[model samples]
Target: MTSVHDGEATALGMAMEQSAGTVMIRAYVAPEQMGDWTIRVTAIEAQVEHATPGLQSYQLATDVYAEQQQARTWTVTLAIPRVLVAGKAVQLFNVVVGELPRLGFLTRFRLDALALPEDFGPGPGFGAAGIRQRLHRPHGPLLCRAMRPAVGVGTDTMVRLNRDVLNAGYHLVKDDEVQVFADNRAFRQHVEAMVAARDEAQAHSGERKGYLANLICEADELAERWDIVKTLGVDGVPMSPVLQGFSTLSMWRASGKCRSLPTTPSATC
Candidate 1:
């Protein structure tokens, strides 16, 4: 059974308890801001039961506040009842703070892990089985390469670099964290250049792909950046979960109903 502590406005250091059969849950949520906040806490099973000879358990949780608030926080607790530990191996959950849904992946179980879900885009390039089904190259691990551009590089310079990256057989790329500000390099120029490079590579060797550009704009002017990027056309944009807050990014991704998106880590989001 799934236990969801769904709510709108919340406060700090609030605790709750829940039980499913013999399994028990103790959730503590300490909200950091006003406006809307969403938090989730779940207990999962740990594998290697026979070797460990005990129940393995862990919890996943996060909190989101408004943009004006700067940052938000929360905590979660899961109590095991000796029936069946929540999980045996990895515990996965699709947590949604407002509209942005992030896949929470748990590896090593400790007291807790930061549930601050970063935007990996609206969703994966392909879902679990979907990636394997489409790319047909999913059995092995994947590598990620970030395009850390020179802070002052002009748009044209960055575009040429995109071409070089695509030529080097790098499967994926994303813009650096400091690459957004009132169009110093011009988002339009960057998108057009990268999209064209992506097309050219496909035209010859038939390797069709591109990179996710970091679109850093002021909260007051994010819409303008989105519109310009859409008009120019690119695969996706990178939003930071830490700096912008989760709800802001959630709404941004929601605005693009039919387009693809990716996100990076930051302070708020």
Candidate 2:
């Protein structure tokens, strides 16, 4: 998939200099608006007879930009997995701006592999046993949450629910994906109330809890709401995988705008 890296932690480009395999695809996203850039890459000429998760027809593209004080053009080419066929020896590819990431976006016909930036983080330090050993809570069922849409429940109700949920011993409560509109009491309002409840509950029970409000707004409004949530000092917020899109999440994780982990929730594509 060809995606734009708005200088975030997850936007990476790798270009091999005669097998360079590594030079990040540089983007020039304005700090104020880390916009999504549709990339143009390779695609399939025919459907494969047999394919798995990674072996499928695709058209990828990414826009490359000149870096600061640099004078070279950057590009990337991906080696097609030995599964799908393009009906020809080679194909042309380039970026095609569309309403969404699309199959027809590959028009430049260039080789694969762009020097995209890589995101880094601490790897899993402890397996299940290790985590259990560290926490010393190995004798109970693993905790999980049931996610529900955050719509219909106005801000006041959500605030009350957040409080009640924490008081009832649930460790995590988040706004569902369907809760991003500002007309029915904005997300900021709920976040403020939720934070207060979390603080109160933690003080009373000496147990830490969180309210992950969903950040499912349009890309234009994403960072703004994110800033509001972060400024309020809330512990967490949720993001819809479909609304803002993964490129946005990648950029979010790439930059620390949403903390170490602004939770990513995906609507199945």
Candidate 3:
């Protein structure tokens, strides 16, 4: 049964419970429309409760300080059932904020915070420790460089840029997100060239140098791109999970095909 929490403290406690995921949303309402907002909130609550299965509870709270300062801040805390997400990124997003914008009465809303059950997705496939281990650096900062001149550069130029950076003692070098792959042939060639440059740098420096291929492409091309990079032995990949969609990234990480390769998430989010 769905329940409504009365206070932020209580809502926070519910948020930490193992059985559910919690999200805190902030909404702004005009002073003239307070009454209308109240009515809308009640209606939206009922609608959400009915439409969202595994919705355990929710709460609406006013920020007293913000109200005094005329900021009009109101917060909503939602406790959703854990089973609904099941370690899937898309499902987690859907259950939390997918239908929010269309619910009306909230011209301005922001997701302030989110708390997931401890066992979210398969965590990071190769996190910081894994990267450090692969690079043979137990501590200290690892220098990484992005192959720039974001666009309009040919494969040879990119290869030269990567080779220079890797040779300059940078631990990792990756393609800029904006770099275009005109076709599969072009992309394969780019990867091959970059990997060869990385190997050469590693050989000369007597240290491991990593190359991360940017895998931002058409949805249909993701699998092929992954196969190419994996087969060619690139150290890692730079991906835009936000642009690719969380589900695609999650699927790839959980697939175990690239378990040994570290993934660097691009700054698209």
Candidate 4:
């Protein structure tokens, strides 16, 4: 993790500095318009310092190559200042989307992926280690299942269903993002029910089981609910990066508030 205090956040310096501040984005451009696209990207690169003062522009490769998706793929790596992010994941989103939209090919371009430096955030806090730990199966395979018929089931009913699965030797059970967290199926009710179910399962099976509650909510409400889920003894949390924004996961990692907890990203992302 390169400290943002090392020097002024110059794009070139950061990009060249062990790839600390580099953020890679894959974009699609037309084969014939490669030259024009290159110029546009270069111009955007040049505008970085102006767009974000104190953050110097960095060098990037502009070679255009064809991909299996029938469009030419152009990988652009931007070196942004670490200070600007200040450990806030949303800043990464701003760094990427803020400048790229200025290009004329915005409509034709498709952002395929983002490759971030490890210092950026502790990605997928639980990951393989956390998942295995949650299952208490250090040397064996872990199991996971989601609550079916996604919606319309009451909180109590969902709890009983989850309890049954856990007692049946399932390692973990998660709620569908759409099933709860809405007006009718309140988050508090669902979390309380889940905690109760987990307790019952543990007492009955004599083995640990995990519950991944949906933490999908409006941005303003997420922090509050996340804390509640943790304090209430839920095993893990499931969130939709697309809906809640990727920064949400970043915040969870960078904030150090949920370091011990595991998070399950919505499969749709």
Best by lDDT: 3
What TM-score does model 2 achieve against the real structure? 0.47
Better structure of 1 and 2 per TM-score:
1
TM-score of each: 0.48, 0.47, 0.69, 0.61
lDDT for predicted candidate 1 compared with the true structure: 0.43
Tell me how many clashing residue pairs each candidate has: 16, 41, 0, 0
Instruction: Tell me the whole-model lDDT of each prediction, alpha carbons only.
Output: 0.43, 0.44, 0.64, 0.57
What local lDDT score does residue 16 receive in model 4, on the 0 to 100 scale?
38
Model 3 alpha-carbon drift over 4 Å, by segment: 1-73, 258-269
Candidate ordering by lDDT (highest first): 3, 4, 2, 1
- Candidate with top TM-score is 3
Q: For candidate 1, what is the TM-score?
A: 0.48
List runs of model 4 lying over 4 Å from the truth: 1-88, 105-107, 124-126, 182-185, 260-269
The ten-residue window of minimal lDDT in model 1 covers 8-17
Alpha carbon RMSD to native, model 2: 14.8
lDDT of 1 by residue, 151-215 (tens): 78776676667667766665555677676555634666666676776667546545545456566
